[model samples]
Target: MEAAHGTSHFLRDGVVMLGFALGFVLLFRRLGLGATLGYLVAGVVIGPQVLGLIGDAESMIGFAELGIVLLLFIVGLELAPARLWAMKREILGLGLVQVALCGIALTAAIGLATNFSWAAAVALGMPLALSSTAQVLPMLQSAGRLKTPFGERAFSILLFQDLSIIAMITVVAALSRNPADAGGPPGWQLALMTLAAIAGLIIAGRFLVRPLFRLIGGLGEREMFIVAALFTIAACAGTMELLGLSTALGAFLAGVMLADTPYRHELETDVEPFRSILLGLFFLAVGMMLDLQAIADRPVFVAVAAIGLIAIKASVIGGIAMIIGMGWRNALALGLLLSQGGEFGFVMFAQAQAGLLISPEAASLFGAVVTLSMASTPFLMMLTAPLRRAAQSTEQREEPNNDGAGALVIGYGRFGQTVAQMLMLSDIRVTLIDIDTEMIDVAGTFGSKVYFGDGTRIDLLRQAGAADAEALLFCLDGAQLDAGVLGAVREAFPRPKIFVRAFDRRTLIDLRDAPHDFAVREVMESAVTMARAALEMLGENLQDIDAAEQEYRRNDDERLDAQRAAGDYGAAREMVISHQTELAARARLRIPGRPTNRTGAGR
Candidate 1:
């Protein structure tokens, strides 16, 4: 009877979580909001206080553990030595100063105002100094600000925070003051164990990980790769535990060592599902820890603490951003970006609890501060546009008038460069901008007028003769995004003819419906080429291929026109399903009896 009741409770918990996750994802999409925020909200809704779905969060902590491990590994993969070196000034210099300043200032203030001891205040401040990378990065990517200077600065600072968490772990472990316990391992023993463990991790990661990857690669099974990644994570985490250090520190070290691998990105991709699930679980577990009834009893205090934490963090970050020469608007944007107490805060606070570094009440206060501040970031980012526009209204702006009269090619890839080269051969000038610096350097040696930067940036577009250009060619890879770029072009240079390339059916639909003058797919060009070759082999005259090409162009244009009128690909795909037979019959009629190469007969 007891066993059956336990199983039933477990089943109910799983069902509730599943329902919450489904509804959460669906609502996020429906509302056009970030899924992270949606997940957080889902946790709140299904929390013990709200729905009493997840009655015991302790069972989910193991899953949360896996999430942090995978997340740190992925973070390490992104932080290759070269990239880390590139941002050293910001990460080590500005980042270090900011963390120290914020921690000291906030801790002192809390100690002075409240009856909290210095140790308790320091514990509170330590966690609050960190910022949420999971939240900020996704938000920046969605806003198309990830490649901006401010974004780069934010990323550097976040990386520093991640690295700094290891220090926090060591400090918390060392300073642990249990009332019942007299002492821990000797200081030298602790130091040696930490060093040896770190050394062991480096040796294993450097020697073991690559060969393991090679073996996994040889298996030619994706599941094997995932298994290997999990094994490595667990092994490292277990090793750290044996050495009396936090599993996070071990996982982070493992990641840092594997950062230089060619397979790092692939590893990241493989582990992404596990990372995402774990991260969601972590957030849910955090939500479950919220003492809602307690908060309800002390609503004013919790609310004040949440609000005060955000305000203090924002003010400090804003001050630093301004001192670093960011404009008021940019400072405000960055301030909000850095205002949150991150996932590490939860980890640190949990550690503090285990070590008896803080009382239960203090830990709860820390949790409230972290959750409320993190929850407010999306809303804060929403204010960026208005704040920026307001700043622009009062500032004098310099608009560039194009000095070079040319065709502006936004991407200098194979397709884009070919178009630019062809135009140049015919004495038409061309200017290009690409985000890859190496590509630009190589293109420059060939006398190509190439600039290195993201094409979506208005400033880069303007410098690339956007206004004075005769035509704009959007021949980049990932051309579905061209529709959005076209909108920007229309706003900047509405009169220019926009020539674009579509990769497939979906992109074709996107481009067809987009407000642009010319939209062509590589499929059309390849089809024309194949037709020309077939004509040569069949002893057909030049006029035949030309006529066939013209017919193909006409057919594609007509298809696009019809699809655009329908406003979505579903209707167009249905149109294809309904008319494929009729189109094939029309092609057979157009081809004189039987076509030699049926593949090239029509698009």
Candidate 2:
């Protein structure tokens, strides 16, 4: 292909890809379904074997691979090594049970029925062992099951499952035929290469990448920070590819090493846009690969496969959850949540195809199964909530707290402490619940009433006056905690004016739309304090200060409106800063008094 011809082809390919992305984004937003599914649907629409609008998934797959790297990086950044180890009972014990037992049992049955070789069946089973991270996490988060004991256990197992995906690539590579070469590197060499790639990533991460990011960050160029993140991922992956190991493994290693770095969160924030695009493309590509024709030819086979896969997986997971001390409701929820095949299954299937370990038809069949499983998860999660409500209604007899006339606060962190202290001063009577032992101790020392307990625990809620409390406040920062506490409170006292704290704009939107009577940002108090200081420094008399502050708030509302219009965070931050500065100047010009002393402004 000539260079110009190649360039033209690339541009054409890019346009097709962008069209798929745009369509999915709109569909996802409109349907209240996740964008991941939309991407898959788009892939099916444009895929060559289907509409033939987009032929050859090679280029798109490459970008989608980048998405996988970013996704794992974000996961690693959140999952610290110590925390992973702390959840070993779940990650190792329960996780191994979920993956290995399910894999072996499912494979044995499939192999026996289809009369396929054990190897091919094993290959199929390996993919089935994986559960969709894209599907499961979002559902759990939306349903408030994320921080329940079941949620933590499920998350830990999923984390291990994610890491195991990279390992699966290596396993498939090793198992593949060498063909004419018949002289590929020995097993030891391959193992050494994998180990060396990992060690190199750790060394580079600790001694190199962090410092480079710090230097790039100092340049005060956000674009530079973004570039630095991309470079780190690509370079690390390329290095591992050169070492005859999986690029995904190398990228994951780099992420794990940087998990504890201060810049990890910033890196995650910076890479989100790219991650979304890449992940969307990946799902779209997977959708394109679905064997629609095969399903058409063997509709019965596909239907039985889908139904059988879900039923078997759900049953196995429920058994495991029950064994692990999950309540019946939680056990059922866990089973439903994990009954789907995850994206990593596609990764495994790709490696299998490249290795010639599985026939093309088999690969396509497996892909179809995985995609269907993922798509069903949202509906499954929706079902879980209604079922849980029914279960709760049938089980509970009477209100736990007949004497709770006070306000109930879940979480005794900074936000919770402030609210409790204010309530105490106002003599409104408050009951505080927290999972943090230290916070409970501190609250008691300060002569504040608090209980050390998980807010998600129904018994704990009862002890904290859930029934009689006039209001409920959730000051927890984690989404899982917030949702669980909210659900528990709602179930216990359906009529309370539930107040909650949100950590970000998305959370705020969710909270505002939620069935809460009041929703406030965790930082709103700090914002008020800063506003007071700014107004005092601007030489405004108390009377004029109040008016200016109101105007400032009004201006902020307008600024936020502009920000959502722009659809870019960098622009939004700039607009906010500009508005604050401009309003301060305008307020100062209108104020009657001279500038206040720094002490008076509490500077």
Candidate 3:
């Protein structure tokens, strides 16, 4: 009875936490404050300091730290080894310089600001040099700028910060005044262990993890992939824990090993939800653990420290970015975006407490500082919106040249090439536009001039002579077009005939409401040809194969028409599945002297 009662209590806590989180997140998000702050506020409200609804914020935090580890893993998956190497300059230059400068600068500031010695200040301050990865990354992703150069640079610095966590730990351990830390290995030993662990994890990833994923993939078990992805993170993180190293780094390394693998997208899809929930939980726990009494006692100190931290980091980072040749506006935006003290600050502060570098009260004070700094970011961004927009407008992207061309091909990939060549065969003047710079360079070498710019952008299309061109063929790969884009294009320049290359059947169905002269399924023709060849290889007559092909095409068209009008596949599913038997019956009826099975046919 007691065990059942405990389970109910546990369920109650879960319900309260999630419900409060949802409500607060919705409110904060509606207010344009972002969900991180909402989660933090909810945590505080539900915590012991307020309503006392939740239990053991510290233990909740320990479990929630997995969110950080998973987030690093996903970030690592975005950077393949080759890409990481390509970013060596920014990682080492901007990242390393920014971290070193901020650490030293903050250390001095903290040392002078409070009663702590130089060592304690260093321990507390180094963590503040790191910004909230959990906050910044989601913002970049939501803005669809994660693949942009600015985002890449921001991520490079964050990646380096994650890598530097071990070094920070070592610095803290080396400066320890506690008896417990006295028995730990020296900094040099820790460094060697980190190197060995990294090497082993990489080897295991190639030998063990990839093979494990391959086996699960061949079995076609998506559930197993989820299991495998989580297991990989746990295994790496657990290994790092055993070695007294950073588990987040371990998970990150695991992700990096599989970064270039075919399963990267699948792994990201599987692990992202867990990362999000845990990350939110992490922020909540951080909030819950924030000492309200401590903040109330010295609100001025907390406010000043938080503001100073933001100011110092932003100035230092912005200066470095400008020195590295970024425009002042972009530099300022980047700095403000990363000004908040990171989630890892809590971990470092805990380390400081364990090392006897700072008291729990001091740690809580700095934690509050970090939290306050974080809360200021959305406001900072909102204030800088105009500057960022102006900077983006002047960014150096190749513009399309106006040529009195009859046809403009948007993509220069395999699909676009065929379309362009076919059009040129008719002696029509074709203007080629492609977003891929490398492909354009290669095409130039082959004496083909393809302009570089986003073809989907309405302004770019207009500049590329979309109005004057006889045909505007969207041959870009994937489902880049939607009803919104198609509608805009149609409304903007209705004179040119529009053709779209759909990635699949779903793409075609999705844009059925949009106005377009024609939609070409990227693979439909080739697939039909392959099916015809297969039939021939199976000893089926060409005449019968043609009939079969014609029947399938007719049925497909009927299904598409039905699906388009109904806005669902339910009404069209039977048209596809039931067509086989009908086709066979029709074929038999066409045979000479075949018996008619249909009603009133034999008469």
User: How high is each candidate's TM-score?
Assistant: 0.65, 0.64, 0.70
After superposition, candidate 2 runs with Cα above 4 Å error = 1-20, 28-32, 383-385, 391-603
lDDT of 3: 0.84
Q: Candidate 3: which stretches are off by over 4 Å?
A: 143-148, 397-603
> Over the stretch 45-72, how does candidate 1's per-residue lDDT look in tens digits?
8877787777777668666867888888
Clashing pairs in 3: none
Q: Candidate 3 versus the native: TM-score?
A: 0.70
TM-score, candidate number 1: 0.65
lDDT of each: 0.73, 0.71, 0.84
Clashes of each: 0, 3, 0
lDDT of 3 by residue, 1-603 (tens): 999998998899889999999999999988888899999999999999999999689989999999989988987787766567888998888899999999999999999878898999899889999998888987886765555667878989998898788689778766767776567887667778888999999999999987787666656566877898999999998999899777877888888888866566567766788999999999999989989999999999999999999999999999999998999998999999999999889889998898899999999999999999999999999999899889778765321222357888988999999999999999887878775546665777888867655678676676556776788999999888898998999898888889999998888889998999999899999999999998788666778778778877887888888888888756666666453566564666472232445434652
Off by over 4 Å in 1: 1-8, 25-33, 179-183, 186-192, 389-603
Looking at model 2, residue 106 earns an lDDT score of 78
Could you tell which candidate, 1 or 3, scores higher by TM-score?
3
The Cα error of candidate 2 at residue 513, in Å, is 25
